[model samples]
Target: MRIVAIANQKGGVGKTTTAVNLGAALAELGRRVLIIDLDPQANATSSFGLQGVEDISLYEPLLGGALVTEKIFPTQREGLFIVPADLDLAGAEVEIARMPNHLTRLAETLKPLQEDETFDFVFLDCPPSLGILMSNALAAADELLTPIQCEYFALEGLVKIVRLVEQVRDSGANKRLELAGIVMTMFDGRTNLSEQVVAEVRQHFGERVYETVIPRSVRLSEAPSFGKSILEYAPSGAAAQAYRALAREFIQRHSPPAARALEAPEQ
Candidate 1:
């Protein structure tokens, strides 16, 4: 299984949106997917119609209170699941900081799933901050998938997050950590600025950036408000098709480690 942290410290960059929609799209393609909403905003949780949830979050798990599996809640989708987040998680950073192996606490908590192979992919929907929660998410992830908006400042923010990922790798907490991919979102086909930003990102990251650019779709933005993914909300829309394409491309790029290991020649 692949543990991917869908993170971008800058808000409104479609980070959580990618996590939610991508998880749904992957599940639609017969992959077992789980999204751990690490944001206090709980946008991911509410995006799936799970509201006013209590004691069913990762707050207890990260603090040594309960196992993460116990907090796992199934969404309406068959193969998709979620570990919801609430306001309590905002306060968890302080308490988590005082704990032993704070950075790896999330990793340690998630070790069981890594062993059980419970899901094909576990996407961490991180908050827009550089706090303990974000640190723990990076430390626990096998790879980081950041969603960059198609805007003027996207490149600068991408550099910062890439540098942070490098730091997380060098820390030895998760030496396997790498930048999995960069997803371009909020793309306006009518704007030259959008094309320019995508060009600049591809210039720097080359093949690390995804080819499927998520366009600025009103239906995509409205899906979350109604507690649904783009696929469920407007499956035939351009946004939904884009995410589905992304899921296909993602599967091609991020094959399970065991599969990759099997493919590696004896050396």
Candidate 2:
């Protein structure tokens, strides 16, 4: 399975939105997808109309207290599942501060799934901060996908994330965690500024920037308010189409890993 962490240290950049929509879009394409909402806000969890907190959550599992499987819950959509989050996760930063190897807790918890080949793709929606939660998510991921908003601040904030990725690499917490790609979100075609931002990011990242740019559509913003993805809320809208294109881009880029492995000679 290919695990991806949709992360950015900046808030309101469509990070959770990309997580929910891309997960849904991949599921729609006949791939088994799981979304692990690492954000304490639980926006990814709430986006699917799920808001429950009894015992199990990322907080419990990462604290080395609960099994990861125990926190997994089926979402409203078929082929899509989520390991929901809760308010308790907000305290994890403080709680894990005193613990050893805290940054690798998420990677340890996800080991079983990776070994057993449980799902086709796992998307981690990290919190908008450079805290323990984000570290754990980064350490556990195979690749990091950053959703850049079409604005001036987007590139400025991205430099910090690049530095964090470099730190993770130097620390050897998942040396394979590469910069997967960047998706430009909330794009406005009418604005030259939006076009310039996209051009600049693409110039910096080169092929790491995706061809699919998510437009600033009202439907994309409105879906989460109703606890749904654009696909479920307005499947025919530009936002949904953008998400579909993203899924296609993701699969097209990473599907080779599976195929190449299958073709390798047996030991």
Candidate 3:
């Protein structure tokens, strides 16, 4: 299974939105997808229409308090699943501060699940910070997908994340982690600023930037309030189409062999 962490140390960049809707879109394509909400805010959890913090979450599992598989929960989607988060997860950094190999705890916790082979994709929605939680997500992830909002500060945040990824790798916290792709979110085709940001990001990241840019749409923002993804809430809308396209691109980029096979022949 491929583990992709949707991460950025900036808020309102559409990280959770990408995780929820993109993950749902992948499931729509018949992939067994698991979304682990690593953010303490649990935005991804509520986006999936689930509530309650309960005794199970990645917090407890990675900290050695509970079994990782025990915390796994099925969502409404047939093949999509989630390991929801809780407010208590915010305290994990302080609690596990001095624990040995704290940075690797999450990676170790996820080893068994990755080996299970039941899931084709695992999306970890990281919080908007470079704290231990984000570190854990990095440690657990095979690839990092950063969503850059179409705004003035977009590149600033992107640079920080690129640096952090370098730091993490250099520190031996997550040597195998590599950037899968960069997604441009909240793209406003009508705005010159948005166009500029997209161009800058593409120039910096080159082919790593996804061609499917998520447009700014009210429907995308409003879906989470109703506890649904754009795929479920407004499947025919622009936001849904954009997310579906993003998911397809993501799958193709990560699963090139499958993509090549599908393109191979009418034999």
Give the C-alpha miss distance for residue 27 in model 2, angstroms. 0.3
Candidate 1 residue 223 C-alpha distance from true site, Å: 0.6
Clashing pairs in 2: none
Query: Whole-model lDDT for model 3 versus the true structure?
Result: 0.87
Residue-by-residue lDDT tens digits, candidate 2, 67-112: 8888888877888999988988889888887788888888898887
Misplaced by over 4 Å in model 3 are 261-267
Per-residue C-alpha lDDT of model 1 across residues 214-260, encoded as one tens digit per residue? 99999988998889999999999999999999998898787778876
Q: How does model 3 score by TM-score?
A: 0.95
- What 10-residue stretch in candidate 2 is worst by lDDT? 48-57
Across residues 141-215, which tens digit of lDDT does each residue of candidate 3 receive? 899999888999787887888888888899998898888789999999898999999999889889999999999
TM-score of each: 0.95, 0.94, 0.95
lDDT to native, each model? 0.92, 0.88, 0.87
Decide which is better by TM-score, 1 or 2: 1
Q: In lDDT terms, how accurate is model 2?
A: 0.88
Q: After superposition, how far is residue 243 of candidate 2 from its true place, in Å?
A: 0.3
